[model samples]
Target: MNIPLNRHSPTPIYLQIRNYLSRLIQSGKMLSGQKLPSIRVLSTSIQVNKLTVIEAYSLLEADGLIHARQGSGYFVNPKTTVTSGLTLRSNFSPSQEVIISQGGGSFFEQYTTSIQARRQQNIIEFSSGFPSTSISDNLQRVAKRALAKAGDTLFREDFPQGQLLLRQLIAQMLIQQGLEVSSEEIIITSGSQQALSLAMQYYLRKDDWVIVETPTYHGALGILKNLQAKVIGIPMTAEGINLELLEQYLKSHRPKLIYTISTLHNPTGITTSLAHRQALITLARQYECFILEDNAYEGLKFQPVPPPIKALDRYDLVTYISTFSKTLMPGLRIGYMVVTGEHHQPLVKQKLLNDLHVSTVSQVIVSEFLASGHYRRHLNRLRISNLQSRNVMLQALESYFPDAIAWTIPKGGLFLWTHLPNHLPIQTICSEALSHNVLIASGAAFFLGQGYPAMRLNFCHTPEDIEHGIKIIGRLIKNYLTPSFISVGLSSQEVSVSSMR
Candidate 1:
């Protein structure tokens, strides 16, 4: 194969190679089953590294554009048959549903009841990013104490920012994390979700450009879209967001804000390294753009937590947002934001008008929880359980799934992101899994408009549940990929039997 390489293109050389080969296959120049050169041969021919060739081949294989034979060579997919020398019909269809069940909007409001209707149902749910129930008891005990001390004053209109006690606790925590924020800098909100919403309301305007990670938290994407913000998505890699591309986008478009989940990121579960964090902060400062840091999962790390981007932010360009939703309890609806720079007071006033302050009772309850040192101990226990669950899930995936399904080995977070064969639609798989009394989130929910085929699995369940659920999901995926299964319709018994294996 004669392939020209571009040295000037900002895109990675491996991706360029992948794209070139993909075009060839799509154009029918490379027929199905045609053997390609080995990775070493390709690397030598292209004057690139062998690892680059390997990466290109892996990407092609993941996309089902090509297949690999052990100890042989890569080839166009042999099973991708053409009829009468015409192109094979597309097996995938775009999703037409206006809204997804587990996605943005109030779909949860209506579906939450129906989903919980089957209290006896033993299905392991990976839909919501729920923290374990073990942490809830600690919050509950603290709440009871708060209630007893309130004596009716807690319900009255209190400090607009939040209870001073809660703010002080948040400040202390930030100081421990190496951030120079004080109690006055912290503004409490109903939840991190609310904090994000408030940030969007305060900063973004109609048609303002906002930068986000390609597959980001669905809730944040939804809010940005609803705000009519012109959103640009930067692809995420194992290291972090592509900082080079981010710099390019910043130089060109000059977006209003860059919203990111830097620590224990959602869905993908990749943490941004300190080097990348500094680079991003520098880029944001250079571009005169603001950084909205969503550190919602900061405490869920099984490993030592990486310092947040805010810690490295010296110019006050970063607006740090986090919550106790994952660490303590979601129902408390307690979260806070540290907004620096000149715009802080105006943002606070908007927040006051938006909700007239978060519930004082909840803030006091959380404050007491943090003050008693119970929250840290509870987090330690939760981390241990979460780590065990994550390990078990990793083992199950490795044992049962094919190598074609790639995933990130997250350091710490509730979810693991799995990239399925691009040809297989994750939404279809999710629908099929639902029929088997198993539920997994479709990867499409994370994208802004059109999304790639992927899924996020939460490893916050019991080991048995994790094992059983992975087995079912893995088998379902295998059946979906089977040539015979695709040609003929799948049966309930066949699916169940495969799941049992």
Candidate 2:
């Protein structure tokens, strides 16, 4: 093996040696299953201390790129993909997050694994993006009425554009929110997810440039990856997406779409200010780009919220979407989007090609629920319940979480984004929390490339579990931060107590 040692550099000699060997393996210079030089030989060959060579080999072994037998020298791990010039994993992981060089790495794989693990442990998802269970009774009542109304047409499918009555109701609701649009412009979808997919399918082509708010909605990011679009994420401040930065991107990239959940944004809990909304609309018009406004968390605000960006879209530049999933019930699978202009016909046709139409029975139920004003009453009750639940979560976070941890206090939404200390190992924290049967949504899943130490905590679904989970998680973080943390993890008795709590 030919290797040069740089003694004057700031990087540790062990790390440098590890990196050189890593490059050789990655570039296929070192074949898989090939033995590395013996520690004595390499140490003498490089004129380095044996300890430095040992440390380098140990690091490589930990990376799964190499292995050692009791008697044999280190050999490259045959299972590695480095021989083919592929990385074993993305830079982002549950344990340590590094800045992404490119977007569209598979975040769902890690995220879903965490969820499935929690389910195996029978963990009630406090980190669920779903709404509070308190509305189940009201939902059942409306569902029955809807089923009765759909007795004959239950088998008959609605048009490709969706059930007209539901669209009319959605149009009415949007009008009240100051977005003037006729029912003809609206298309009912299976859910906000489908609506988003339809829009991306209609307007975006492979390799298309798309702009989105940093740490926006995870679902939208997932969709963007499926569509094979190049995603540009604009970091958001307390005010909202940085307009100055957005303008720079708009000027440079002129992306075809700007996808955002401007109202009580998912993960972050920020509602873009009305002035910012108006500015964004103007920018979209100037750049001839379309704005896809995902208002999934439109209502449930603790206070009067700003109007959606769609409301200010005078040039028909904004495609507005919202759903009953967050406000009412998710099982309904009913959502709608108002789209007109050039993209209208294709979206309807594409939606038809996808699903003939959203569930007819579900749409009928939602229509009656909305037209009878029951939805309004339900929304009021929902706001109160969610507000109380959010407060419970906030208090728990404030009381139990470490001082190094900071979190958002969204005015009204199911999520509170918690930012962990940068230097801490998020992967270890996530693993420890799982031992306690608590789950958290990794913040990395929501970003295009914004790798940071954070996770989104859901407050509505597990209101009762907030205090308990927070207590357990707080203790775990404390232990990990202290000098005594030795990965001893939680005791079985301790885990059982947590599960009981």
Candidate 3:
């Protein structure tokens, strides 16, 4: 038997032998009941060690493709009966719904809920939307320091708009960034999700057109879907969303709302240039559409990005939203939006209707943290630690991942967006990853239409786990590639990490 091998390749020799033999068996090159060569003879023929040949034979034996008699060599198993493709398709059931009956939710709704509610587990979290919990102990100190000078203002609500001090603090910070705004313009909420939902409720009616980037934030997409907006998804280029397409849609459809993440955009992490920002603002003006800018990762930038689209919103077309979820603590659940147009009153009214207002305590605690000058220090530390984490993941991707795979190494932010080779079955690969105790955010969930062969990996995980998870994913992909048909090796059973080792 001729077995071609690349001894210098990173793939283990035993795995290569097993795969090659598996391929031959499936292809019927080796006849059923044919006696195989002895280990010593096969090793000499392949110019490999005897142990390597033995391990390969052992694997094939375990796979049930070959059998070794008591004193004789191995023999290939008989070919399994083949079912016609048409017969299988005739049996295929389309439109079947997997009803998970815990609360009886729709598939997409249940999917999004499960994603958001993934309990903290001992396993590495590659799908988390929040930062690490290493700061939990430190936050007690922040909370204690924030409460030092709490007067009656801390006990009682400041006003209908929210704690006036927090609003003033948020407004002052925006002013420092060159936005002309006041405390009265800011509306605090439970989190940016609430801020976004309020904006959606106030402006968007059922079937009103709205524009969003392809591969946009899933949360925003879910909100827009729930609001029943006629959503238009523009493909995002390196600079930002495709402007040509934006203009085309604006001229044709005239969407009422243009929701965007102008800086360090969510999954892709591509920041819009100042020119792109200016052009987008102009497009909104030309089309008379409102801009809803989510700036959740604003302060997390390692390299400076262009000023936010909201900063350039002299036209009052932009409703700027930000939150402490990315920068400080998600548990605080405090976020605010700056509204400055004719819709300001209605938006604030919607905010009041949403939850009356965010918790008085959260607003006060966040307010005190900002007022104490500790927030700036916290921002600095966050940038440093996250950047290091980003580098570690980048190195892992470089060392462990294959060359055909493409990924983004963001200047900041917790995610690394990756594109695998097009032909790979990404869903099956993701399913296999789950079996290995590794979780990933499939690129399909982020798209409005067909998803690319991609995944969004969180680089902010424990460094050791990051390395281990990525290496495991790479190996799984290679294993799939080896079997070619995604049906050969893993046809009847899963090849797990334990099995691989």
Candidate 4:
């Protein structure tokens, strides 16, 4: 029980004690079911107050590392998993520590859980990352037909590279969009998130530099965080990521990869141009860095756009990823990535290690959907419906929101990135909106530092829900702007709600 205590350190004494014991227990130095010293004995031995020792023990107990019995002293929890080691060893160097709000879980996980919790509640949910469109009957019939066709094959394990049929269909679909990719170059993943995770895991080492768009997909940020990569957020422009600033970063920092969502980008519906895509590939070649292009929302575009960055890549510098989750249905969990050149086989191996490929049933169904042309028909209907939903949300924002707020009008996509005056309490507005049963994503989770004064609103809700949710959010923002609204510390009810619909 030899513990070193740094009295001069900024960390509190109790936390230090807890952390020390946690490391010991997790490292298996202190075996499960081992009894800890009595609080009085440890306090006297360590020359700390008994209360401090009690607090340390209490914290450990809270974390399920230790438990107490009525007659016995605390014993290590037998089922405690070795998670403390993972928490302590971070990718961040002392100088490059990311100060974003990664307090509990990453925002992506938190928002996903939040969406799930609020599913049955009579609430206007703008927090969802998935599209709000319902599954078409055509898709159901396609699924049934797929089952009939697949029969016993669905019970068998497919190749780690994915079912050849689905990959071929995806490749054909991409070729129509002007990207020349072979089925062998593609690896199926659980979703684009899995593809993103695989690429990051494959290319990144701790403290290895990786660049992403500021206010980018929080899920990607979460993956980068887990990998302990040094993330550099390049500011995004209306046309896409700022290439000039990106080149500056590439010149100074030799990042292993640059991640971007070039078309119908999440949270902001901005799409990159053909010239921008070409120039980006050129920059990647010059910098000797790879590009991870997340084209998840490409199929949901309201209008025609440039081919993917991978299409413009002549040097095999780009690894492109997309998913049926966004276009068809998230439950499908079918996504694939195209890796050309030397990285393809390695990534195929990585995919083999990543859940042994996506679900066989999902792949078969999606393949059938694609083969029957139902996916294209579904996308056409979804694009139109999504556009109308976006229009409804925009109209609601314009009609009810305060003049201090501004938002983007995405041509296609599920989100509307709304910026408030920096002085406004963005977090407070979000909380109040939630109190009124309106869920919105805080902009802070998307950045490297204290996030911007902005929020991401999903337009995938029904037109009625969109209008109602925006009206409520608009009113909340208006309350913040009022000169007479001085009760920042007051409860949610006191802030404003008498006029809420």
> How well does each candidate superpose onto the true structure, as a TM-score?
0.73, 0.73, 0.72, 0.75
Off by over 4 Å in 3: 1-121, 151-155, 482-501
Give candidate 2 misplaced runs (Cα > 4 Å): 1-122, 134-138, 461-463, 482-501
> What digit string (tens of lDDT, one per residue) describes model 1 on residues 1-501?
568888899988988999999888879888888988888888888799998997777656544567665578777864322123321121222221111112144334423732562343666777657675454554577789978887787768976688888899899877656687888888899999888988988888998888887678888877876787777766666666767667877887788999899987887888887888888888998899999999888877765566788888888888999999888877789999998878688878988888888887788778887776566656655666676677777778877776566677776768888876656757677777777767787777677555557788888888888888888889888976756434332111111001110
lDDT per model vs. reference? 0.74, 0.74, 0.72, 0.76
TM-score of 4: 0.75
For model 1, the superposed segments whose C-alpha errors exceed 4 Å read 1-121, 134-139, 482-501
Q: Supply the global lDDT for candidate 2.
A: 0.74
Instruction: In angstroms, give how far residue 407 of model 1 lies from its true place.
Output: 0.9
Any residue pairs clashing in model 4, and if so which? Answer: none
Per-residue lDDT tens digits for candidate 2, residues 191-251, read: 8889998898877999888888777777777788888887777766666777776887788
Q: What is the lDDT of candidate 4?
A: 0.76
Question: Which 10-residue span in candidate 4 carries the lowest summed lDDT?
Answer: 88-97
Model 2 backbone overlap count = 2
Backbone clash numbers for all candidates listed: 1, 2, 0, 0
List CA RMSD, all candidates: 18.6, 28.0, 22.6, 27.4
lDDT of 4 at 263: 88
